[model samples]
Target: MGHHRAHVSQGHERGGGQTHEEHSGSHGHGGHDGHRGHDGHAEVFRRLFWVSLVLAVPVVALSPMFADLLGYTVPRFPGASWVPPVLGSVVYAYGGRPFLTGAVQEARARKPGMMLLVALAITVAFAASWATTLGLTATLDFWWELALLVVIMLLGHWLEMRALGAASGALDALAALLPDTAERLTDEGSEQVPLDALRADDVVLVRAGGRVPADGVVVDGSAHVDESMISGESRPLRRAAGDRVVGGTVATDSTLRVRVTAVGSDTALAGIQKLVADAQASGSRAQALADRAAAFLFWFALVAGVLTFGVWAALGDMPDAVERTVTVLVIACPHALGLAIPLVIAISTERAARAGVLVKSRLALERMRTVDTVLFDKTGTLTSGRLTLVGRAAVAGLDDDELLALAAAVEADSEHPVARAVVAAHAGDTPAATDFRSLPGRGVRAVVGGREVHVGGPALLAELGLEVPSELGEAVTHGQQNAASVLHVVRDGAVVGVLAVADAVRPESRAAVDALHAHGVRVAMVTGDAQHVAQAVAHELGIDEVFAEVLPADKDAKVVELRERGRRVAMAGDGVNDAPALTRADVGIAIGAGTDVAIESAGVVLASDDPRGVVSVIVLSKASYRKMWQNLVWAAGYNLIAVPLAAGVLAWAGFVLSPAVGAVMMSASTVVVALNAQLLRRVDLDPGTVTGRAADSPSR
Candidate 1:
């Protein structure tokens, strides 16, 4: 029930109310607004970096340096000790403004993040130094430290933004593949229009070697389209009239006239972008815990800083108490803690997206790291979902090739699925017959090579009282067990042979299934087919479990049952029937070839419709989680050590950590966490294997 509600909330039923903003080719900053925010933050940090660098010089110059260099005792101005504090104030306000604003926003929202931590620390150091400069006894100075902290933090943020830009090469590649302008057919020949303005049903002429402008159907010409972006097949696909082509795929040869079917957000390329965006915004329960911790740190730092100051003032060490209070405030904000999880998650999400695996939520991604069981739907998930001829038997005189030829000719005029199977099987080998006659739900008769031919199921053959051979009967029986349709070929009034075709698994299935097991995840098969057929598929794929003849609602129950057993379940499917189960599972993975369900239910969408994509998402999730943990540990470790030093725990050992020094340490720790998260871009997450049986080719 919780899962159902969550899916309902996240489902796009609110309507596409998408207001189009003129986005001039923005890269992956999650979305346009996010990109703007990032850019604004970067600009602020850049300004701060330079200003703080300038302040650091003055800060050093104001410190005993000029006095020593000139060998002259300079008269201290009224409250001359305040010079460092005033200069440090400039650095903190100018360089640290963004952090302060961000910290305040987080505070208002009751969630303190990196900004909150950094702002609190720097603000405290500035306030304390100002008081000390005004003749209020303060034990230590933090002028240099505060200036250095601002500089280091600004440098770190710039580098982090650059890393984000660099890791988004996939978006760049995708953008490069699409032509900015398309030639739309108009009354006066062709008009050049922005690609997005090409509406549905628009006729566009794509020249030879041009990329398809939108998801469209070939209207008047044929071409070989390189659909590597959508299908992941390195080879180009042969397209004829009435065939659908996705936008961004290159047309290798032949000029094609295509009628645009889906444009704007409706195109396949746009769908991929949406999936990538959705994946990046996903989150889990564990992430909530991390947010809670950062929020707690904010309050803790505020209260501890106040208490430290009160205690020292009561004990007559006013200056020392004020300094300790500043230390507490500076060390308390978990700037590193704020960045620990999000940075790694961001990098991992982008990394996975580029590989064509869109991660929907953090929970889904995290579960991928430790999933114990994976369930796959048979059609369109493990298998190609298309029926094709895989077996044929010849009569007493006819050979196997001749049987296929006769079957293909007799079924040439039929529109039934079985007839189409025969046609697809012998597509290029035989010329279709003339004078074809189709009998609805019964058979098709056509004149092939000046001879009459008839093709249909056993019933059609029985109508003519044809004798069935023992070999043919045995083959039909075996085929029934495997859920294959048997088509009989009849020529000159006699049954010549039989063709057996079934929906087969992809050729990549076997290895893909084994790879999942090797990763410690058990594979299961769930299908709406009969038990025997399901068993046949399971046995072929070496699946650990099978659930057959399942109703759509029952699939949801099965997922609940698996989750009840303390297993993290990942459901992979591309059918509407699988949507409920996909939504119910711990992780819902939809194949890209399955556009509707992929958008509706799954948290992870494999752009290439490869079962191997499941393995890729899991690998990336694990790598991302590991990086997050590593960064968190290091960030927390720095705080654990720095907090004690800042409080003068080692003062007796001649190791007093000054306010400036504490601020610098805190800033360094944040950069370390951010940089560590950036390493997730290098994680190798190949789906490695794609398991399938030989009966049919996988979906395009």
Candidate 2:
């Protein structure tokens, strides 16, 4: 299983009959506020867009230039001449307010962007149109162009906000998983109470098909729990008594009485939400590059607009100069460039979160694309970390069952992991043992049915100076050669039998290594286990490199050695000893079931204990980076071509762009970038099907 971080929220009583409030940690991205707050901004832009569109119709119809271009004459009316200027003024003030305010914010920060470019273009158009209306100069009227530009810009912003809202819907979906009320088990039966009223140790009844009110363990009954929302595992897992059930999961088929272990912000769902928010807020190298490019473009447009106006005015008339300059500024707004990277980052992070791949570092995610090697820690990461009986041998008269039972009876009261494995493997009821004694760093001793029995490893055998009989000696040698820990069982100071124990390899580890090879990434193993043990596992998984018998503190040095060979390495581990190596690697992936120290040091955390999640990380990294480049190339290329045309470069061929038409092209470019980022959602990330082709490849 992957590393899982457990958190518990503090409980408090409600005052004045009010329901207890659920408090979540403050996310850097402002949690739901970052998305919900945009609702008002989107609504304002939407309302202004429609209203501006309505007011622009008369302005376009009454403008002399528009009528002349269409080969028509304006109909004379009592108030027709005043309609264009009055409505154009209203559109500029009302519809363009957001852009005006945004420009001010950017200016105050000394980093002008798309908003400033837009504000400059419209302000010039507004001033020039009123200049013509008051007879200040005989220039072409710009009232119609100003009105249309505002409406188009407003429409574009509204669509952008809506797309952001859709991407952030993941947070809302997570929040909705918790039920408002819970059925608390009480003395008189079950009583309904608010979800926030649930405290740790409170037994709650989770009826069939009901959401688990909080993170807890099953106390009574059994059920299949659908944890897909929390763990991204599609199949419902059978959860019996003492099984942990996270809040927001559903008990599908049977009712369960669960003892609440955590509530509110302490739940796993809350942590996942916080991770998503943090990833979105984190800055990346690519984003910084995009920001720099946008800042440059802002100054470029400002200077180019000035140069275009000065050159045209010296060579021609002021009217043509104003029109060309306005077009230049409008077409070079950098709207697409500014949004290119941020949009891709937002969508990709949300997509990764939904797949149970939590990205703690944006830079590590970016680095995953170049990884050449994947180094996995052996214990608990690639293996189950639980000892299993692999081989057994018995003396002449003692059968295998008789030998195992004797060992189990002696170890029944010991708290060592190996002792538990022995007891678990025994089939029949264990004989009663009394006066149990634990030998520190050795094994255990107990009186089983009035016979003094002792179970220990090689140390115990040497201390007692009792040699293993030839019949069991061969088995002990074979077990040692195969990297299994053999325990010598002694009854009444005489060696009786031997049992071999080894940590079992997980079924997913082989597939995980094979998948990495399929992606052309070399796999390596690092472990503090003995050379024979580590090598045996490496050979089984087809690992290319092995670093065995390394101390926990020296694991990071192994990662450094790989890097010194010019290898871009990714490390996957699940222990406190793995923390240094995890941090030293190019990309550190912590198993969801790993320790907190390992998790904190990792750049990515896999929610499932399955090793296939490593493959998912690589796939997502490649896909997300591809989208980022596609957007950058498009945004930069659009400006390269559009900026010159808007400056009247093709006027000699009778093709000059008006400010209104320039605004349309700019908005279209922004829409294209947004749509391209959304395509990342279609990439297949399901761990089950993710490595199909890898499994069929020849072993390296």
Candidate 3:
């Protein structure tokens, strides 16, 4: 039975498989537009706060409450009483406008939030103070309280908006990577043109230290390209003729002529920008839960305020009822609750980027914490994706070095991957070969040292009717079982030796797998390679599961199958073929060197093509989730205790919280939430060491 069939049941879509562009286009604008409006709103609040603070000084000095609290007599003046009302009205009109407008919008949407609660609190104080001034009520003057409340709310919102603005600036930073101009090559010479003017097939000249104008293949010259901004690979990659280069990547040294393949929105940089925008804009489950809680709190505070007014009015007077109601609303505005998750998300995302992990979805980051299995793609992920000589077996009459030298001399004229592997394996110099001739379905034949020799696979062996001698039979079987392609080297029509070639495994692969196991996450590998090839790689890395011979289209089915079997799977890959699988997993992690389509489908992107980045994602996800929970609990706990106190629950014991004191408590709770979210920055995300040991060696 197939290994996947034994472990996986049936496939079902669990709300995964959405591409980054689809998620971004659907949700990106709404969030950024909201943030832009918040930036404008922040500026308004900041200005209003400073002005209101100045206006409040005279209003508080002129009030009886201020004189009584500070043991000072109000200066006698003809119009001092009017000063308090005039300045208090200005503070309410200017400083409280944002809350009032936000509350109106929230009410229209039929979803009141912190804005509505704040609006209600300040409006109540305004009405009660004006009623006292007009001799319609016996309430103590609340003009000083009203001034302080408006200023404080404005300050809180201003600080919150600024923090969010700074976090969202990442999108702007990404877009700024593209240069404004390009050196377009024409028949006469090179001419600088606007970046937008460069079209597909346009040849562009890229100088040393200049950025690539568009995604293209290098047609001439060579250079070391710095793709750190796009892929998070700090080392510059060497690019020669026919090698592909991405737009926004810098050529560190040497000049090149590139044939543009893509420009404008089609470039990889544009795709990354869209992904970042989408992730920042998309709302996560935690954020949605917080929203629901805030909405519920709005209704809860409204009902509590109403009850406080009714109960106090029945027991005391209208003045006492209004005072208790205003305090209740002020204390239960949901400011902390509203800030809990978004602050954590903003800080974590910024930190993730610094560590070369790009979070494309808040929901993905949250889901990463619960991932039980991490499925890795084999080619370009576990292996180097390049052929290399793995082993050599020689007959009793010949040594291993002699066998390799003979094969290399014959295959040196060939350009096939297997030929290159043979030539690379022979460290010493090779004797000259002559009359080289290529076999159509077999391998190559040539004259080396005036002796006829042939090199090929099983097909050549069958063609020549050559049987492997007993001495080399066991080596051939072992090579075949381990998925290494065996090449037979024959001289004078006699089989003399065998050379095994395979895609070499990366040195980091073993360490990466061990690290995941240490973290209690099951490691699995999926590849389109044959069963033996996949099994061989899985065994070397100590992978728990292997899905071999999987077609690109069926990769997602395997992911869904794992999910159906109750596994929280994270698929990591680096190719266009891996796009569907990347989207189908609970969390998709794309290697930086992967195609743009795969990156677009993934929720998290590892800037470097390093599997250890998978470990970084887990570390960041768990740390971020912990901070979110801490802030949530603290915010919710603060409300549980402070709201009741503000509603006069301890009034019989001669203790009551004034509106100013309640405002202070509310602001303090917000500050605590902000500070707790900031603590996520302290998490160590470097993946060079795993479980306190160097990740370069897994055995240790």
Between candidates 2 and 3, the one scoring higher on lDDT is: 3
RMSD of 2: 7.9
Instruction: Itemize residue pairs with steric clashes in candidate 2.
Output: 1-609, 2-592, 2-593, 2-609, 3-591, 3-592, 3-593, 3-594, 4-592, 4-593
Per-residue lDDT of candidate 3, residues 341-419 (tens digit):
8667767776776556777788899999999999998877877665678889998889999999999999899876678
Q: Is candidate 1 or candidate 3 better by lDDT?
A: 3
Q: Which candidate model has the greater TM-score, 1 or 2?
A: 2
Shift in Å, residue 180, candidate 3: 4.5
Query: lDDT tens string, model 1, 186-208?
Result: 88899989987898889999999
TM-score of 2: 0.81
- By lDDT, the best candidate is 3
For candidate 3, the 10 contiguous residues with the lowest summed lDDT are: 6-15
Candidate 3 overall lDDT versus native: 0.75
Query: Could you give the candidate ranking by lDDT, starting with the highest?
Result: 3, 2, 1
Query: What's each prediction's clash count?
Result: 14, 10, 1
Provide TM-scores for the models: 0.80, 0.81, 0.80
Candidate 2 lDDT tens digits, 594-694: 11312568888776666778988899999989998999999878877887788888888998776656656776887888788889889777666677744
lDDT scores in order:
0.67, 0.75, 0.75
Highest-scoring model, TM-score: 2
